[model samples]
Target: MAFEKGGENAYDVVIIGAGISGINFGYRLQERNPDLSYIILDGRHEMGGTWSLFQYPGIRSDSDLYTFGFPWRPWTEETSIAGGPLILNYLKESAQMYGIDKKILFHHQVNAANYSSEHKTWSFDVTANKTEKKTFRSKFVLLCTGYYDYHEPLKTVIPGIDDFKGKVIHPQFWPKDLDYANKNVVIVGSGATSVTVVPAMSRTASHVTMLQRSPSYILSTPSEDALERFIRRWFPVYYQHKLIRWKWIAVPFLLVTFCQYFPSLGKKMFRSATEPQLPPTVSYSPNFTPDYNPFEQRVCFCPDADFYRALRSGKASVETGVIEKVTADSVKLTSGKELHPDIIVTATGLKVRVGGGIDVSVDGKPYNVPEKYVWKGVMLQDLPNAAFVIGYVDASWTLGADATAQMICRMLNQMKKEGVDEIIPRLSDKEKNTMKDAPLLRLKSTYVKKGKDVLPKAADRGQWQARSYYWKDYLLAHYGDIKSSIEWNRS
Candidate 1:
């Protein structure tokens, strides 16, 4: 099971970061084109990506399992929103079922990739377990590294944080032995992570307080889908799964579209759904209300309204204020209030690293990653025989991953048929000038806003643009003409 270092590796394709996106892409590539030789590499010694990295208590999918699960895999669990351990197990099961685990090289961290125009191959410099360095060569390089930095969690600099005496933690690097039972815990930030951890920690923590600068719109759903359960009882398993998957997928798409086009109406409906869950003393206007419209930022999902129940039962509370300073025993707020806590969980945000923080060059020149436009939402502009799988922000991450796989497989198969060695996506001069500039990711989440500039750009329209809608992306990936945006060359 141990992947040893010191050998020079070569393959038809080299996939970096064997996470959800990487595993899905590798599985599809191997399934579609059996003749192609590929290897999946990860810095971590496991197959599951985010699922493996995150170990915070009560950590579950922000989205439902039906949509979050891979298209090829049927999520047979009764709960639609599964915890981290279950998700990790599902990913591992997927790897074993598709034989992707055998093709994966664990502890292989990609440092840089250099593409040669004349040789038509990518050369990689990789480090294994931070000790041994080795070279790898492949006809193409596929990056499936998720956006967040795995080596270090994004830590925010709070004034006087060094003076704090309490145990501080980031959800990304939750300690295995740190116990919080019967302790006062103050969780910073109002994102999905904060909401999730608040309800979970309140169960044992003497008091859990969620401190936020601004509120994220929170919604709740049943952990297990009753309709899905009913369908499973009456229908064939495969048919039921497919039906539930498509239904869940479509509902999100419709919700996103509705919010996008009708912001006011969407906001009103969101507040209505949230109001009944709040305690009588708590107002939904300021703390629970968001200034941004729905889908601009992702709506936080609290399964079965446990977060609300926790708040109502006085186990946890929410505070909206900026942190002025952190003292030895408490955190001072701008509103002239101080919070005393035994523990502080700074779920501030994630630090986004484009292309897995790996340097990329083309023919001895540094590749300008942020300057390139997305080609059909998957491949970067002017990048030859390379693609990076980034999933949907609006839907499940795997939805975009699956679409990217389908598109890449089609492109690869076409190149094989035409005897082409390189395929590069190019934006015409007119296309570049005519197109309007937009952020690489449409979501206005805190983590995204902080790291948007370093990421790639997207055009206003056409095949070169990026979209979060799964149905549209799925159709384009399967049926869109590859010749329109890319130039195929034999050299």
Candidate 2:
């Protein structure tokens, strides 16, 4: 049910972004409050935002699908890592099944949003198909715009790049027609993107070279197991979801918490069991050690048998040096080696974009997001009548997103019962400083890391104190253990 259409328009919430995170949030909203009037808007034409846009060959989820997929739904497939199309299809089916598809508006991209101090509402300008602009007002603005936009080619400024006669492509924007068959390829960056492409291009490409300045902390894990198969086959959907959630998610989450607090024990255990999984040629130097735990910075992928097969095929190789220059047909390595290349895939990785390009303001001025602080990394503290749905970098993004959903429900309940007109989380000077002192995910490179100013950081709990793992996050938001750290009450 919706309100009468007239001059007066006020929806319960307006959710931006229709990716996995936003889609899940929208479904949860209606499930919790069936009568709540809301809209899920996205800039793209399809329901699967990232999965749709990223159609490069061999794109797959690094996180295991069981927990990483969705809470209400479990991945029924036998494969451990769900590829782009499969994941996209799953999201589409999930949306349709829950009736969240009706609330979605494609091609409707949000440009800016202003929070009204008086009305306690959010005003937004949505542009669709470039020319059509529409205005809407909502009691609560939910920014589910996944991260920031795609990171364009890196700022590395590789010399002679223009001279390269061959094609240069970023994995995010790979054209469908670009063929790698029988072509020699030089890929830039050793992050997740490069790692994924190595095995994929090796299958058909004559030769594939991975260029890296410094090696990333990459680890491997199996995609599926016999036990997982048996459980899924025997169990009901809800039962499977719970079992998979706890087994895959809860265990890892607790381990992450243990590691953060007790680094020595965590490191010792991981090095013993996890480190052995890496090929003998792999590096485990402290330089590559993430500022946080193993899964803290980003989840490393384990590509069942395919990754190893690619490595054994000799078609896949790695180069650890800077690129001094690129010629039309050759790349000059920092080590003074000129390697000929037929194709150059600059898989240099992506950057973070905050609030999916939505403008956030406080006190009639542009909000300095990183400085303001976070309410569990989802809701903005200083902003009024707004909350965002962002995922974790390490663990399953859905875990953090799920927590945000639960917390928003609690916040809504409190608002209804308390008649709260406003909410602003005020952190003491010391508490605020502490939050700034320790960030959950930290990467130094300008290309890989989100700029402190524009994109902003999730002023969230210390990944150590508050693990990004699913179960702990569920408990943190559900029970509110971090209450001392948060400031909440009736307006």
Candidate 3:
């Protein structure tokens, strides 16, 4: 069923991705006003977004389950920090329980959406079910479509990959029935995907070799417990936001602060703390560099679970080396070591593609997403009647999106109350000139940037602007309002 193209009716709002972000956007709006008309569209055959496509072994979220799950629905005792399948089931369950499944059109890939100035409606051309092509129209379109692709495996060149006789696969598109029970596996990359595979395959595979370009500092924390809940309830929303913000700030702040305050003494004290954590056999190298701080890029891993279990069992090993080439049955490393493997998993990380690889244009002029400054990281200054939901990376995905959705809902309510039919975030020329992106290495989101502005600035590192502190942001957003936080418009 197409939107307006269905002849008689069109939803007031249409969400492009059915993942947690899009689904929450729908739920939040519906809860705010049950009469609000909307439908969610996903490219996959099912409702789960990333959780559905990434079927690799031991695929589970790095974040805690408490806030990561959903806004209205707490991850009850039966469901918690889950694997891919469990999360996918949760999405399905949410869709079913919310009565969103009927409205969600699966396997419907939205190719492009154009906003009409005169009509103030979005015209969308979508490839549905990979067979029939059609167009749908809506008053507003939410690009909830996340960074990952559903149709194919991300391509990576390993030189002699074609010559390798063993089966090869990307973590995003693993073959379900492929047997690796007694296989020797060599997985490339040290990102989240690689961390998951190391422990999972260890249970069946004879051995799993992990290769990485450089060593990333790893840390762990408990998923959920009484202490966190107490913190959630004990502090006022604003105070809690301040505390978490300071917590994020304290890491690099203390380092940068002490170094400047007591140059000599602080330098000595810094080494005393960090040096003990380095592997005893490996000497400390000043080259250990993190542009911002230890947890800057995203810190997710089960504390003393999969990653720890794999290391303790000696079934999984880590090596800092690049892949030089691939052979018929082995991979050649830059260090001249040869690894013969039965399966090679390219956990090399996912490529970020915003707008589902569809180009965004305004008045026939092509515009890049990063070229514009992100207003509260949701509204693009120059876009009218539009908002995209962003997920939590360090904290909880649902929490971040929930706040974004709330703010947008507030904007919509304000617009209606004030007789306004439009709202747009217009960028100032100076703001655009100073516009900077968060660096690619330190960011895992779909948007790309040249410098540090892409991630939340250190000065703005609290619940509203910080990237890693999930609980802080989740709580703040749940109670926050966008109408108060955002600059809007009226008719």
Q: After superposition on all CA atoms, what RMSD does each candidate show versus the true structure?
A: 3.1, 3.9, 6.3
User: What is the alpha-carbon lDDT for the whole of candidate 3?
Assistant: 0.63
Is 2 or 3 the stronger prediction by TM-score? Answer: 2
Ranking by TM-score: 1, 2, 3
- Model 2 TM-score, all chains together: 0.87
Per-residue C-alpha lDDT of model 1 across residues 330-438, encoded as one tens digit per residue? 9999999999999999999889887888989999799998888998888998888899877877788888888988989888888888888898999887887788987
Stretches of candidate 2 above 4 Å error? 1-9, 151-154, 229-238, 254-296, 362-364, 429-436, 440-450, 455-467, 481-491
| Residue 90 displacement in candidate 3 (angstroms) | 1.9
The whole-model lDDT of each prediction reads 0.86, 0.70, 0.63
Worst 10 residues of 3 by lDDT: 455-464
Q: What is the TM-score of each candidate against the true structure?
A: 0.96, 0.87, 0.78
Query: Clashing residue pairs, candidate 2?
Result: 80-223, 148-353, 163-328, 164-327, 164-328, 165-328, 221-302
> What is the Cα-based lDDT of residue 315 in candidate 2?
81
Better of 2 and 3 by lDDT: 2
Best by TM-score: 1
Distance from true position, residue 288, model 3, in Å?
Answer: 10
Worst 10 residues of 1 by lDDT: 1-10
Give the per-residue Cα lDDT of candidate 3 at 3: 18
